[model samples]
Target: MDMVSPHTKNTTELRDRKRTGEILMGHGYKRGAAKLIGVLVALVGFGLVHGRPVDATDKVRIALSVRNVVFLPFYYAKDRKIYHKHGLDVEIIQMRSDLQLAGVVSGEIDYTPAIGPATLGAANSMPVKAVAVLYNAPLFSLVTPASVSSLEDLEGKRVAVSRIGSDSHRFGSLMLENGGADSKKVTFIQTGSTTVSLASLQQGAVAAAVLSPPFTGIMAEKGFKVLGRSRSLVESPWLGLVTSKQKLERQPEEVKNMLLSMRDVITAIQRDKADVISYIEKNFKVSKANATESYDEIAGVIVDAMFMRDDQIKKYLEGTHARGETSKLLAPEDLFDFSLVRGLK
Candidate 1:
């Protein structure tokens, strides 16, 4: 047999070394991890090219649809970035109606700032729960020209509402019926006015319209009179925080933390109105006067009441339900999951 050359033996040794390194380092398997890395890099690049969506598990998403003066504190909370300060990655989206349940069930959002209607939704099997009570009571009213003089004058005259089934429309009807007005006698107009219901009356569209402040303040300054105010303390309603049952079960810690954050912000608002008014004006595009006045109004009427002084959650439901305002009675538990407010600071 021919003697093996030393150079050939060295070359074979090098080849063996290379094969051994490959196998140890997972060469065939490298493609699996490399491909994963490449896909991740491409995804990150895409997000950079466009906009990165929030990390679902890491972000706290909330949807708010019940809009108005009662809900203004949420705007203040959002505009001020209070949720973030509390170790939350919070997102606030504005929706035009009480569509909280769809988002809750589908996981499009983690919670809603308005929990009143969600109380109604819970009764209907939407699998949602309230995290906290924002306003201790309702903050809505029917405003009209001072010339109208009384709620009686509102009949036969056209009335304006944001939509057919909005809190304004439903509660306005209840207010009228409670005051003994025939619902059919008044003409209802849909104007989509969220915060400026008073403007509807100014524009000569209706004799009376539901309103929230700064619009309420503006109308009062402009010589309009208050017709009916939604008063939860004396048989009205409350707005609170709501989320899907799934969120409650999956991320109870996050939900609790967010509520604590919100309460801190709310307390801060009262604690520092001058600063909060500046912030509200900057973010909401309101007149400085409106911001200042509205902030003051909210302290007495909206915040710090725990859903009404008497806490008659049942009486409110009975009052509204009897007047055909809401379809049925709502359990108090249906309105709030106080564990967060009760447990967390």
Candidate 2:
């Protein structure tokens, strides 16, 4: 696979390569200072120091829970060599939410971008903290076949989620309750992924499924009824970077560099619209029109500076109440540390 060197690229001309078979942004206009002040006190680590490529010696591993559109930032970054530019030989791996957390906490995985599981894990007293907030709104839709006209109609029907304690479940439950439906009456099957959930829905194994774009678009095209979209049903932080407390304490430079690279991705998306839309089209295997639609729906939710407000953090933590009462008590400070992101240009 041809990889773009982080040191050079016309942002507009960047193209995504085939993922060796796996499926898998700009506003830019700012640069961090040159010279590392040591990880112990460096607030803003090396990211874009005059667009110079840092030594890519920081081998980092990031675990992705699913291949959803919300994770487009991570995918785009690797494709565009943003992490490499920041001195990170980042490896993106797919893992289940449950396992992703374990990997992060055990130092097996440096970071996992599934904010829902990470926040809930922190609430449950896990030693992991979110470093950034990517999407503040849930980009999911509670979809069912055309026979299901409303959220209430799904009572006693089966629903498909990625996993029992995963974000898909949380979003699905909230989508139902916020729509005045009894979530308890619905049976949620752990399909382990949106693609599987979609299969369950199509196979008649479930009556509804919580799916993100472009699955929602595909289902809608097939005449599925969208009872409610989570974006309108609830406001909560969806995806972002999360790492073990140990990583934060021991390798702050890696953390800060990762955050800065993410900031770079967000800024790139803000400035280059065509590249992202094209990426959506190829990455998601959707029509040009569908890709454009997904881009429009997802672009607005990307966070600025990868930081969420205090209130947004509270709301997001509250959304995990179903996990346990302890989840409701986790304050923003306990789950997030935006120092790295705050110091970026």
1-345 per-residue lDDT for model 2 (tens digits): 011111122122202222211221021223222122232112222321111112345357777655555577888898899988988888776555566666565444578777776665666666678888888787888999988778988889899877675667777888898888999999999776666777789989999988877778878888888888888866777778888776787778878989889889888877888999898777767878777878877787888868878987777666466447353577889889988888876
Q: Estimate each model's TM-score.
A: 0.74, 0.80
Query: Using alpha carbons, what is the TM-score of model 2?
Result: 0.80
Cα misplacement distance, residue 90 of candidate 1 (Å): 1.5
Best candidate (score: TM-score):
2
Residue 163 CA displacement from its true place in model 1, Å: 1.4
- How much lDDT does each candidate structure score? 0.59, 0.70
Q: What is the per-residue lDDT of model 1 for residues 1-345, given as tens digits with 9 covering 90 to 100? A: 000111111111212434433532442212111122234334334532111123443555565543343455665666577777767766554443444455455444566655556655655555667766666545567888888767777788888877766666776776777666777799888776543344568887788987666566667777788877765324343566777655676667777777777777778877987887886566545678877877876776544533333366666656656756456666667655666567664
User: Candidate 2: lDDT of 101?
Assistant: 69
